[model samples]
Target: MQAVYSLPTDVSLASHGLGGFDELPSVDVIVPSFNEDPRTLSECLASIAGQEYGGRLQVYLVDDGSENREALRLVHEAFARDPRFNILLLPQNVGKRKAQIAAIRRSAGDMVLNVDSDTILASDVIRKLVPKMQDAAVGAAMGQLTARNRNDSWLTRLIDMEYWLACNEERAAQARFGAVMCCCGPCVMYRR
Candidate 1:
């Protein structure tokens, strides 16, 4: 899979006085979505596109046969316009786990970042997690998840609280275990 932005032109991405080059780990972010709300998806993508890391990053949009053509169009359109983005549309609705595996197969990076379609990443998310992959046994590194739409409704607020509490407890356990069975569906990063 080739990025729309290739060589030379892309290579000239140097900042005037950025003190030359520093080694940075590459990352691929895989996001699975099925007919997600457009506004939410936009926010999610925007957050990723806004990451502050200087590493080579790629985004995989695994389309699990979204029923809404318009929503799918928006995602594909973004992919078409952005070299860092890739769109993999499944012919039929497959499970989320399957979609993730497919994205992994297609990813071309030193590490992987798995996120929910409706979730957004913090600007420093990648910079914070990618460095941890340098440790040989560190298979994965997860980041904090803060709800972005908790005020949308009472139900959303409740879910936000539950998610927050669950994440808090899980993070503490993760610190002890140094491993997580399944990283949080949103805001988690992994090494290849």
Candidate 2:
């Protein structure tokens, strides 16, 4: 695979003046949606908007033929309010992978963050994740995922446990040796 960002191995983390790094590269966030709940999508966008990274950031929302007009309206409103937000509306339903690939092809950032429409990010997510990419050999990274509806149902609770074990435990072990096998689609970052 081609490397997405060219990070300097000798770069100092504290030289950027942000108490972390200086001259941080831009990051483009890609979100793919198909008839997603407007409230959820709004929360996702709000979370991204709250990021504290001191660098250029852009958001690309790929609508995969969502039939929900209300959801579309919400998306359009966000695009209008945020100068950094862009939208690509498909005429027909396409798979998530296709939507993401299309958006990634159009992104111009040194790093690309793929987040699901239903996922909410912490305010410091970009700040935390960007540093991981400083390692020249690292190409991709992912954040932990907790169930949003864990208290709503037994199934959700069970899935939450599964996420902890599968993502936190199993993947953490694999990532230690620089050999992370797979990345969860809910929230992941990739170079280029």
Candidate 3:
């Protein structure tokens, strides 16, 4: 069987410089959605817009044949004016992979960030992630998840623990050698 390779990008004790990279690569963020909650989607897009990375960042918001296209209008209205955010509306609903492909085929960002519609990122996420991908041998990188409601309930606490183990222990160990077991889909980065 094929196992996925995923690990967190180590930004701990990060230096102010670009980790020896001559120039930071441009990044394209592909977000696929199908009738996603407008609130969550808005938050996700807002996070991307708020990235502190100093490179060119383009966001592709793809509507993957949502039964209610209007659900996306709220988000569209929020980000439509931002030149970096492009909305792609598909007439029919394809799977997530296909929706991502639509943007992949057209985007020219040296790095591609495949983020789920509901995922929200920290302001420094892309800034920290880019330096790791600057290494020539590195093909992809995964970011850790932070549960905004980790203390809200037992389930949230359990999930938070799982994320810590999966990202910090398991994935971090494997990532030392450019090997990861499985990347979390919500916020994985790739080199194009």
Ranking by lDDT: 3, 2, 1
Worst 10 residues of 2 by lDDT: 1-10
Local accuracy of candidate 3 as per-residue lDDT tens digits, 1-192: 111112334583157376556667789999998888788788889888988877899999999989877877877877989999999999999899999999999899989999988777877788888877766877777787766667778887787777778777988798787678677778888988
Give the residue spans of candidate 2 off by over 4 A.
1-22
- Which of candidates 1 and 3 is the stronger one according to TM-score? 3
Q: Tell me which of candidates 1 and 2 scores higher on lDDT.
A: 2
Index of the highest-TM-score prediction: 3
lDDT score of residue 78 within candidate 3:
76
TM-score of 2: 0.86
Ten contiguous residues with the weakest lDDT in model 3: 1-10
User: Against the unseen true structure, what C-alpha lDDT does each candidate score?
Assistant: 0.71, 0.77, 0.80
Residue-level lDDT of model 1, residues 1-192, one tens digit each, is 000100011112233222132467678999888877777777778788888879898999888888885656865797558888888889888989899999999988988988888776667677767655556777776666555566777876776776666567866686688665665667677777
User: What is the full ranking by TM-score, best candidate first?
Assistant: 3, 2, 1
Which regions of candidate 1 fall more than 4 Å away from where they truly are? 1-22, 152-154, 177-179
Tens digits of lDDT, candidate 2, 27-146: 999989888877777778888888877889999998899999565686668665898888888888889999999899999998899988888887777776787787678888777777
List of clashing residue pairs for candidate 3? 4-181
Worst lDDT 10-window in candidate 1: 1-10
Task: Report how far residue 130 has shifted in candidate 1, in Å.
Answer: 1.1
Superposed Cα deviation of residue 72, candidate 1 (Å):
2.8
